[model samples]
Target: MSIYFWGLVISIAVYLLVGNYAGRKVQGLDDYYVAGRKAPTLLIVGTLVASFLSTNAFLAETGFAYDGYAFLMLALVAVNTSGYVIGALFFGRFVRRSESLTIPEFFAKRFDSRAMQVLAGYTTVIGLTAYLLAVTQGGSILISDVVGIPYGVALVMVWLGYMVFTLYSGSRGVVLTDTIMFLLFTLVSIIALPYLLGEGGGWNATLTALASSEAKPGIIAWHGLTGEGALWSSGKDALIWALMLGASWSLVLAVSPWQTSRYLMARSEHVVVRSACIAGLVLAALYVVLLFGGAAVNLVNPNISPSERVMVWAGMNMMPAFIGTLLISGIMAAALSSCSTFLSLIGFSVSNDIIKSQQWTEHKSLRMSRYIMFAAALVSLILAYFQPPAVMWITYFAGTLFASSWGPVAFMSIWSRRISAPAAFVGMLAGFLINIGAKLLDNAGVLSLPVYLDPFILGFFSNVICILVISRFTQPTKAALAYFETIRQTPKEELDPAEVKKTLIWPVIVMISGLTIAGLLFVFYAMPYAAAVGREFSLFSGESLLSIGYGLSVFCVGLLAFWQVRRVYGRKTAQRATTR
Candidate 1:
């Protein structure tokens, strides 16, 4: 057998072993759902990054980069980082404090309505099912290409791997394996960049080839570029694209069931906050490397059509046999991490929220969770087999669904007391319906809506308007008002102001220094150079600019990793000493 096949087999065996080990520890619903809320900051960071940075990063975004839409990388980084930052600053502590098992449960409790909980639960399942389908399809395509198998067989294999892990280990298995997968994928992704750049004869040569080739004009342009112009228009559409995409994705990260569940799994609010920051930084650094690698892949082979397959082609052709095997394995890891997360979320929503099985024991609930996961996996497999639209479209659809249905209600529940249950329900419904209408119209070609003004933007605004307008004409129940007061008065752990200042000092310095350097580079070098070169300006050249940027990013990421590891282990050491 080939080395690639061996690698695949070994990786699968390792994952199954890990899942079995974790499965033994699953004693109750608490352990199954949120790992008993004892996960450390590092584990939370790993799972959060692994779950969110799935095939979307490896497949979709890389495909965009391969097609010379490198600007999408910037847009994605800006939006995704903003999402993490907002979640850490505003939503993390609140969600952690709520002590809710799921986002839908939080909504149900905050609104004082079981109906709202059921609605939220159903919506979560439907939206996340769509997401699961996309991830599954992406995984199948990658695997089928690598193993030289039929798409149907690959689809079944992918489903089986994801479902088995999810069924056995639940969140515990998911988080543990996610941490391992994150490390593998991050290393492989970073290493792949230099290899591709080298294969393309370095940055300048790569850019020259891209510019001279029959690729899209302005393929190197930072603004006004897209994969299909489905989510962004051309020319003068950059600002709106950034705003809508940023806002919509940010809300999804803050309020989506799968994302919010990570916060609740944290050991403490402090861990939640720190993990968010670390995850954001790690993700930003990784994307810088991965996107650059994807762009460089065009130099290796510019004619790889259906662009999504470019990364897979690069893995097979642009690297050594062992590295190629590892890269494909990393892609599998990404797929499994995300697929398992969504499966687990669906299981929880159905068993805990929708059914509301009060008479079941912890053991029974655990078994039911497994059964639900299996069923969800089967459903996702069917969807993947039918072949969905492009992965990014489905991703955006699911993201919009979550953002419209849950975003406004989540923000209002925590920040405002005047939003009645009726208002919340109606607003959520209106947002959802509007989003559906917009999508149908766009898909049917009945309206050529500017991609910048996508469904999420419209639905979000609709939700906000409905809440404000309807709440003005309605009264909140006394019980709901009391609950709001209780939430308002919930005391959080206070950090020392001096400690906070000390923690802020280094990051503030680093930010200022980095921004200052960037400004100087742009003002003195990039602008003058670009103006001189005119429309032929090559952004990838100029004294190894891309190399320097990527190097610094990697260095910063190393420092962040070291700092986090030291902090976590230092605490352990101190605790051991005290015990002695």
Candidate 2:
């Protein structure tokens, strides 16, 4: 077998071993669903980052960069960072305090309604299954491409891997394996980027070539009037892009059931805060490398069809075959990590929420979870094998479902006292239906919506309006109000004032400064240079100053991340010593 095949084998072997080891720790339902709520800060951050950096980022987002949407990198960074901060601040502590195993359960407890729980559970399962099908299909394609195997065989192998790891180990195994994969993916991507950039003749020549080529002129333009005049017509498109692509997607990640489970698994409220910050920083740094690498591929081989393959092609062509194989394995790691999390969440929804088996023993519940996991994996595999149109059409469909259905409800549950269980249920159903209706209309060409007018915006607002209107007419139950007050009064361990100042306050300052500087660099230097580049820009010239500038900005952000992690962990160590 080739080195590429060996890399795949080793990756699969490591995941199986980790799953077996973690499976031994599964003593009850708690362990299966939430890792017994003992996961440390680093582990939580690892899994969260791993789950988010899936094939979507590896392929789809990278393809955008290759197609000349580099500005999206900045937009995504801003939106995702804001999302992490918002989630950590508003949702993380409250949800973790609720001690709920799933997002639907949190709703049920918060609203004191079994009906809402069932509705949320089914909605999550449907939305998450759509996402899983897409991810699994993407993974199968990647494996088939790399291993030279038939798509059908690769599909089965991918399915088996999902079943083995997630079925045996549950959340504990999933998170642990996620952490390992996150590290491998990050390290490989980071190592592969500079070589890829070099092969593209550095950044300057690449941009110049792209600018002068027959490809869309807007590919090189960052902001303002594009050379094509249609790609980003005005600031309206930019705002819409930021809102729908950046904010809505981030909102889904922030409030999604699969993601909230990570917050619930955290060891403490402090860990939740620290993990969010770490994840945000790690994601920011990685995106810098991946996005730039994708754009750089335009110079190495401009004719790479189906732009999504640019990253994969760059890895195989730009690096040694062995290293290339390892880099390609990172894509597989991304796919499996994300798919496993979704599968686990789907299983939790069915066995824990849908079944409503209050009388069942913990042992019985754990066994049922495993059985559901196997069934969910089988369903996903079959869906992928058939290559349904939903795979392509459901990108925003799934995000809109989660964000519209749960976003408003989750916000109201934590922050609003007037939201009744009935209102919450009605609001969620309304949002879900509105989103589906809009999607059907858009897909059928009955109504053509602007690029900015996504289903998420429609569904979210519809849900909010329904919630506000319905709650005004319907009184909240006294029991629900009382429970909300009790949770509100629960004494949370306050952060040490000095530690907070150093870790939290300073990191925020550093991040804002880094982003501001990066933005200025793009607006003033990089954007103008790309627009002005003519035939004079040489391919063999010295390193691109623009590329170096972007790299430096990324480095500054990364530096702040390292500083943040060290400060938080140092404080954690000091606190442990004091307790001892």
Candidate 3:
């Protein structure tokens, strides 16, 4: 067996050990559900990024970049990362305030409608189940190919690795293990980047080659390859596609059950905000390394067919055995972490929201939740066995479902006083149904929609329209209005002056981070690119603006965190409340 196989086995063994240790703390259902609602910023951020990134990122997204759209993917990033801050501030903190065990339950309580909760739960189960299958199949196939194992055996082995911890420890294990995996892939990306650059004759040579390649005209351009047989035929079409899907994915990060649910485990609203800012920073940085790294692979060999295999080709052929092993193991870890989260949510929802477990005993609830988790795993395993893998496409569909269906409703539930439960239900249903319907129709050649008119876009506008139109005819129930008002209020614990003071370091760290990004961009990226183009660097240059804008976004998000902490926890507000 290859060292890569053993590496994955060892990683899984370590995760299982640590997961079992974390399980010791799960003495009750809430611990299993929300890690006792005491997870700090690091753990929450870890799970958020881990769950969001899977094989889909390394394989599919990187492949897309290698196909000559690194800049476009980065274009998508500008819109996507913003959601972390937006969600943490407006939607996520309020979710913590709802104090609901699950996102669906929050919806149920917010609208005072059991049906809406069940409906929301069903969406979470179905969407996440498809996603789980994609990752599971993707992971198992990766292991089978690399380790020289049978695909069937690999499938079962990979499933058990994650299911074991998730079944027993739930959120506790997922968060802890996710943090470790996040570190692994992150380190691997950093290590692999310079190797790729050097192999292509460093930054200036590689960018110069990519920029001037006749065979790949416009490869690094803003619109990507706009020649014949390209995925996008024109710059206008490419930009439209970016703006459209960027907005859809932004919503996905904002209020998707998988993403926002992590906030439920946060120790406080402050944790929610801080973690989101840090996640935005980490995610953007990682994308630049991996996606740009993906494009850099072309400088070595541009003929790797099925472009998804580009990174894997680099791993096996370019890097050292150990780095290749780590890269493969890192991808496996991504799949496992995402599977753990999706399975936990699906099982937790089935047990808590759908079946309505007996809450009389903590032991009883834990046992019942585990049982449901096992059942969900079995169903997922069967599907994984039968289904063919389309790792990235499946990931894109399953993930974006929440953006259209739940995005508008989730924010509206919190921000819009005029929204009624009936409006919420219809809007949620319309978005899910319409989006799925459009996707199926388009896939089946029954509909002719452009890339910009993605099913999610159709669903999202329909959702908002339904809500706005229906809300005018119906009034929010008194219970719904009361719940909304309650969540809108800041939590009492957040007002502890000493508690707020301890976290004051976060704003400073964030501000310094912004300065660091700007400095690094000027020194590293902009200067190198200017030399490649045979021009002196200027702040007015495109590369400089990209770096400056990224730094400014980070700075502004941190500023929001600072101002929010002050407005909600300053001496005046603290004195108006009880204890400091």
Candidate 4:
């Protein structure tokens, strides 16, 4: 009856349809898990976007923007860029070549140890569950806020909807539905950005309010160690590190078990590399919009009661009632796309890593994965019902654990040949335990250290130190050497060097256009802030014609890329490879 409920219903219907459609293809395990490994670049791109940008992002990113003690966009830019580059440079080639279904499979093959496979699998399952819990928390918060329903009830409704889609369709459903959901979500933001900017006094009033008020620093300022509190809190440095090295390392090395699930869908290394770069740039641009929206909210209405309501508040204030409903639907779509993947990942991990034995066949394995899905969703739902109101903390813990626990193992697998099985096992153990221990210690006030020195930072170094020290006493396995060889071996099916060289022109153009747009957005924010304090620039004026020029550049590059794609398609007969 409420707008939130209606939005929820519409989102549910779309997902259900996707599930039903995808179910027709689920003849066995492969289709259920990785869509028969035939996913085109577009669907893979959608799933990547949807899975990473969960409800927590919608809430925390905007909340962080409104918190105004940090330049959230800069952190986003750093981490995302680092993650993409890392993926493109190293992990992409390794993972694409392995041809494994799960991250643990890669580990098992690389390390020649079933134990390492099991360890990686369980660690991913547990870590990702925490991440999903955080995502669900944000979704529940939105539902509760809109319909005045209990959090537990809202959580159940959201979880049940996710289960129907994930269980029936698995990753196949995730890819298809995510594509639709991503488009809807992106459209909502694009539509809302212009309308909100116009209604909130054409950016002038918002800028003045943001600059003059003392509620918080603007979005570009550091988040921690304010006027007097700088002596007590390490939020500033922690925020910066989280955005920079932390994001990049975690994302790039993530191909192990976490992102291996996504890359498995891509047909070749080239597709994965190109898609990741494009996705990274697109996410960066989206963050700029979301950052602007979040900042604008605080500028127009400095009352930050419930942090999660930043987007909702802006929507209600700026748009018509009907459009407000559509915005909420967009949020629901974003949340659902993420939740589906979380469910699928948890299920797959539990089935393949925990319950099923190595002797199991494909059909049995797939069935077990579905059961794991049910059990995981049920456990998370129960946890969500009792979770504390601070949804952001859970998300932080999840990200920290994943980054530290898997980051080292994944990095060593590709980067080093000397890392032994025993060393890998012990390193993962030390990293996982140290990370958890660090968090517990900090929370209990048992030790007083910089917050940045938490489990993530500690565990990362611990894995490295443990592996290096232990490997000195151990021998490398044959599988480890084999994996190294695989990395060295050039694929027979790789794209033609000459053809790829031609495609390079478009990607370069796109990159330049993307960078130029980023520059304009930065200036957009800076000029408004400067103008609020009555400072005017000479000659170049922050509001110069260059912004429009950059916009046109993006269009031109897009056209060029389209033409290249068509030309490549036209030359398929001549360029087609003669061998697999």
| lDDT score for residue 403 of model 2 | 85
Candidate 1 has an lDDT of: 0.75
Q: Residue by residue across 1-580, what tens digits does model 2's lDDT show?
A: 6777788888888888999999999988789899999898779988998887777778767876777766545554556555665676567768898888898888888899999989999998999898888778777767777778988899999889988889889999999989999999999998897787776466565555655656555454443234344456664575466547666767776788877789989887667777876787677667767876787777767788666677777777788987788888888888898889999999999988899577888888888888888998899888888874233235556766888888889878888999999899999998888888898898899988887677777888999998999999998888899878876653324444454444455356546655655665555436545455643443222123333344344445445544644454555656656887
What are the runs in model 4 whose C-alpha is more than 4 Å off? 217-225, 229-253, 497-506, 534-580
What is the TM-score of each predicted model, taking all chains together? 0.87, 0.88, 0.93, 0.88
Candidate 1's TM-score reads 0.87
What lDDT score goes with residue 157 in model 1?
92
Model 3: which residue pairs collide?
none
Q: What is the lDDT of residue 330 in candidate 1?
A: 89
Q: Model 2: clashing residue pairs? A: none
- The model with the greater TM-score, 1 or 3, is 3
lDDT of each: 0.75, 0.75, 0.84, 0.69
Clashes of 3: 0
Candidate 1 residue spans exceeding 4 A from truth = 211-214, 224-233, 489-580
Pick by lDDT: which candidate is best?
Answer: 3
Q: Which ranges in model 3 have alpha carbons more than 4 Å from their true place? A: 357-362, 501-548, 571-580
Tens-digit per-residue lDDT, 509-577, candidate 4: 665766677467446655665566576743353233323433443444345444544444324424554
How well is each residue in 1-580 modelled by candidate 3, as lDDT tens digits?
Answer: 7787788888888889988999988877778899889999889989999999988888888888888888777767767777888888779999998888899999999999999999999999999999999889878877877778898999999899989889978899999999999989889988988877878787767877777777777676656788688988887788788777777888889899889999999999878888888888888788878987899898889897777777777887788999988888888888899999999999988887887844547777778888988998999999989887778788889978999999999998888999999999999999999999999999999999987789999999899999999999999999999998998887666876777776666766776787787777666666676675567778787567666766676777778777777776676555776443
